[model samples]
Target: MEAPTVTALQTLKALVALQEIDVRIRDLEKDRQQIPARMKEIDKLLEEKHHELSEEKNQLAEVELARRMLESDLKAEKEKIKKWEARLNEIKSNRDYQALSREIEAARKANLGIEDEILRKMQDIEDLKTSVSQKEEDLNESEKSLLEERTELKKKLDSLNADIAKEESTRAESLGQIDRRWLAQYDSIRKRRDGVAVVPVLDEHCQGCYMGIPPQQYNTVLRGEQIVTCPFCHRILYYAKSLEEMSEDKA
Candidate 1:
């Protein structure tokens, strides 16, 4: 079979517009895929905040329990001190009185320690409660922002989908007008070259690989005499006219 002529190869350039549309569709689909992951990331963040708040609450409860226990101990010590003083009146022996006096002093020291502990625990619980309150507020704000972001992304994704569908329909119609054999060759080359099988000739250079063409190849391309593949990259090549040149040619 004769190698396809350069005029015939030029027809493949029509596919470039189709490729642009397909690229846009792929990009939109990529954006759509990220939407769910982004939402999931927000959900994960919220769950982390909730877990942190729960831990803070538990710490507060523990501190409060400690404070209550200390309070109970202090009250018991005060009651014992009152009982000891009342018994002092009935004590006749000096040794018994001295021993009761010592016991009262020890009870007083124990009461002081318990009161100090209660104070420390109360402070800790207060601090923890404040922290938990702040975290809850932050979590609420973050969730609200995430929800708003999700809504906006959904609207944008829907718009992109609509655009893609319209472009795809147009691309299909354009593809129908192309020759079957040429389309097959285009598809075959595109598959091998990552969706770029056709490239423009600019300034005696192959845009596909930025390689300079020999004089012989350049003349052939200018004449539109025979199809030429880039010697380095093997892509189908064609010339692209500037808008002014195209208009002049039409006149």
Candidate 2:
């Protein structure tokens, strides 16, 4: 016994359906591949925010430490001025007394300059405190927004995975219906031609490559009795009919 013959139109229809499934899978897989990259981007953003916060806190600590050291120095300078004033009361020579008075005046001026610097440091500390507070708030808001975005991306990835699995099952069934010879040729062409193995002949042109078909080949495709390929692009070509014509034919 011999196997029954499969018509060209039947194979073409099967291939068309298979193509639709394959394209859907391709798109779903593409989307699935992007999820990891997007997640990585979110992680990078969070890391940068954390680093900025850490840096600000470190700088604030350093400034506070410097302010404490300045305060200690001021205390030491005040003690020295007190001791020098006590010595002035005990001085007896006029020239020695005059030199001591000028020294006291210079020390007072230096103390005033130190006081001004301490005030600036205090202001700087306050400004840094304000900045740290704002950044903390911003980080909190970013975490909330990114968490929502991550949740949405995970949902999308799960949905895409489910869709891809379902389409693959359908493709398996479609493959079973197609003749092995046709499937092999279709797969080969698809691999060589950017995932488009089958195309419709529309207006005497290959819809896949948009290349014009010769008149004789176009006529042959219209007969729909045998497999035909576009001469220019080597894609399997099917004659496309309007819905009305297809309905009339069915009628």
Candidate 3:
């Protein structure tokens, strides 16, 4: 095969360099997109923690309300027992006295049950208070840690965004090295083939699609006299062995 002219070789080199920038720019943009998603993931965790803290606080309030109600009921029952006992001297008959005694006994039993329940409720309130305190502490720590993480993530997102912008600026500059026709061609193929417009041929195989190129076409591609598009993938093919060295950043 005949050797490529100097100008064609230069064009090929520019194309390679442009492709390099495109690859980097794409990767940086991908990073740009993922950082926000990560932030949202952390935000979700923070929201769940806040919900847990609120639930514990509400539960404590409920337990306290129950304890107060139980106390009020127990006080009412004790007052009734005292008033009924004071009427014992006014009984008219033995039958009436026994009835009054039974009534006092029933009231005392009820008071005892209420007292036990009140004690149990008081203990429950204490346990609930402890739970609320512990939960508040945990929530505060989580908030602090999450805020720190968010700040760090924000920094990362800013850096990735800046890098993406830098790469995009470089891509625009690299476009100046090629003609409008070549740029349009590269853009078209890149859009259709997952941002890959150019590729190398190794062992007569188009690396883009891993399909074998016809021998004659492969030979012409090696000559590099003109831009060659692969038959299967329709991407520009390069032969690194004959032209300039391939970018070490390949892949």
Residues 85-200 of candidate 1 have per-residue lDDT tens digits of 99999999999999999999988988888888888888898899889899989988987898798788778878877887887898898786556766676678778887787787
Residues 101-206, model 2: lDDT tens digits: 9999999899898899899999999999999999999999999999899999999999999999999999998887788877888999999998899998888889
Deviation of model 2 at 168, angstroms: 2.1
Model 3's alpha-carbon lDDT is: 0.83
Best-first order by lDDT: 2, 3, 1
Per-residue C-alpha lDDT of model 3 across residues 20-116, encoded as one tens digit per residue: 8888888888877877888998899999988987887788788788888988888888888888888888877999999989999988888888888
Candidate 1 matches the true fold with a TM-score of: 0.78
Top candidate when judged by lDDT against the true structure: 2
lDDT of 2 at 136: 99
Clashing pairs in 2: none
Q: How accurate locally is residue 139 in candidate 3, as Cα lDDT from 0 to 100?
A: 81
List lDDT for all candidates, in order. Answer: 0.77, 0.88, 0.83
Quickly count the clashes in candidate 2. Answer: 0
Off by over 4 Å in 1: 1-10, 165-174, 179-194, 215-220, 223-227, 242-251
